[model samples]
Target: MLSESKKFRFAEDEEVTKKLFEEGDTDGDGLLTYEEALKAFSKYQRPFSREVFENYDTNHDGKLSQEEPETHSFRIINKYHFCGVFQFSNVVSLSHKQLRSISFFILAWQLLICDIMSVLVQFLLVIPQTFAGYSLYSHTFSYAIGSLDTLSYNGALMFALLLTINRLCIFLFPAIDQRVFGRPIIYGVVSLAWTLLFVFFIGLNATRCYKTFSVQGFYLHYENCENNSSSIGVIFQGIKDKWGRFSTYVMLGIYTLITIWLKFANRLHIKMNKTDGKQVRTNKKEIMFFVQSFIICITFLLESLMFDSIPRFKVYGQWRYAVNFTSNCITIFMFTVHSVVIFTFNSRIKEQLKEIFASKGKYYFASVTQTYPLQTTIVVRK
Candidate 1:
């Protein structure tokens, strides 16, 4: 079964199989083969996204009614990120003091910063323009917004790949992990990646390749150039597609090996521990952490494909907006679910999150999706 709000409809179609992203293996044996696991992610993803949009619409009018987007979800996720960050401090918890020092935790911290930058673009530019109406001042300021958005987004993808590799190495090559992921070496690598990412986007910014609202005016346009067919546009798109494909394949590849190892290890341990076959046992904290990270990568992969494919599918008018909204849902879901998993896996965070939701107008990583009053009339933008 999938998690809350992610329960997928089962279908036998080939397309469904191709887009699959089942949560847990449905087998007497404790493992799901690669084919059975990720087969319906993109297929059912559309309708699942539609449901989310409905939850936001409130009036079922197929439009955003809020002045600011992602406010509730963003606050919840930010709180979780900050909690995880402070987990490393002795002042917060002596047991977690080493978290900030670890390379994995440091990379996670950087990814948090990148997410904030992406949210700033949404908070300042995209949401307001789409809701309140675009302004001359916003148009002029968008250059900087576009630049930061690109830098932060690509930075996130890079750091995610790094985190995946770091996790894999810790399992398979402890010595290499220690040597390569040492504090100085890890910081150096992250710095170099950042420098290269900035230089690349800076070159595109120089060529005047930037962004705009999408045709349906939902999400920000991926790339804006003199004309969509310009060489710079092609390069920008090519990089997006290739980078997306590479990250998906690498995450899938690394985890396949890890899954095999875990299965073998579990088999060996089961013989010694002697457990019942009927229990839906929770995973160890270490295993749970890895599983959560893998899920994040899967969500990112699906989100990228979902957004890119929207334009290509020739969706139009209101339905096009729905597709774009679905893409945004996936983007928020990816980040929001990360925080959810953190609190789920960590007792300290979980307790605080529980307390947060217990209070009125408060939330934790567990989504308290915000709602607002809406106008009865539908205002369609031409």
Candidate 2:
């Protein structure tokens, strides 16, 4: 029951309630019939069918009193509020744009560069070497071409590390994310990673090139590129193979550990009542990042395994050609697809792509439906 003082406080509300009741009482019988209530509600932009009105009647009375109207209003308000709560509770925000602190542009640029390099290596080197004669390039070009597979894997591993680090800063150490994980810092880290990769792998390749040229007085032979019969060549080959695989596995292991820890921490945060909607949303984004990382790692791993399984000189004739073609296709596909997937994960990039296509589509439609003015020449003879 509303007390007199409370009613006085809600006097304006009561007046509006009275107006609504009068509007619903179409026959002016001081009660709302089903049709009258439905019409009144529809005017207010609220859905109220006969069945809904019947539910509000409650006593099977065919008409609703003022008190019944107030009760129905309360029930409807509560029902919508309950639904809103459920929606909020189940919401999972996975938009990468929300993680703005992570430099998506930098990540995207790195992926793009790697993808372009993969394509160039495929067309300019891999295909020509496999199908056309392999005699066009000297030993240096051959060595660089062979090393591209390693470079692509390293590039992907670097990207995965960068993403993992960004997520760690955002979710675990958010207080310092702005200062510590700024764009400049991210840029420096990525630059340093590439520089180190070049110095180590490219430098090693250069050393091998020098050794082959100095000893054999010619470019490294495809038949015995490693010069594996010699002890020093065997050591160098062992180092090259072991280092490439070791670095990739180490990075993957670290990424896996970080992902597991993040999952555990997120669950614990929820259990401890420390998680809010924003935190939950961030967790969802992190999970999506983890999924993307997993895909990248798996694809790169498969490509690397395929490359290692096929020996350039050991296999003969059609089988060697087939293996080379298959491996090159798989490697190029993985790099290209990985870059595309990374771009799609960013909401801003996705929106831009959508807008570009939409504009083009509209233009195409207009061109197809265009009407041109017909020229009519009036005869001067008239």
Q: Which candidate achieves the best lDDT against the true structure? A: 1
Tens-digit per-residue lDDT, 49-114, candidate 2: 554454345345777776531111111222232333222222112223444355644564565556
| Cα displacement (Å) at residue 28, model 2 | 99
* TM-score of each predicted structure versus truth: 0.60, 0.54
Give the TM-score comparing model 1 with the true structure, all chains together: 0.60
- Candidate 2 clashes between residue pairs 3 or more apart in a chain or in different chains: none
Residue-level lDDT tens digits of model 1 in 1-382: 1112311222334344223433324443433333333332333452223433343332333443221122222223323434433332312232135466767556766666677676666666665544333232344577677667777777778887887888787667769888888878888888887897877787667666776443123456544464566776678656755876677778778888888877896576546356554432433644665786787567767877775576688553345445555666677666454445544555665565455447634443123232321321222221
Q: Please give the lDDT score at residue 323 for candidate 2.
A: 46
Model 2 TM-score?
0.54
> Ten residues in a row with the worst lDDT in model 1?
1-10
| Stretch of 10 with least lDDT, candidate 2 | 2-11
Q: Please identify model 2 stretches exceeding 4 Å from their true place.
A: 1-101, 128-134, 137-153, 165-180, 208-239, 272-274, 305-326, 343-347, 363-382
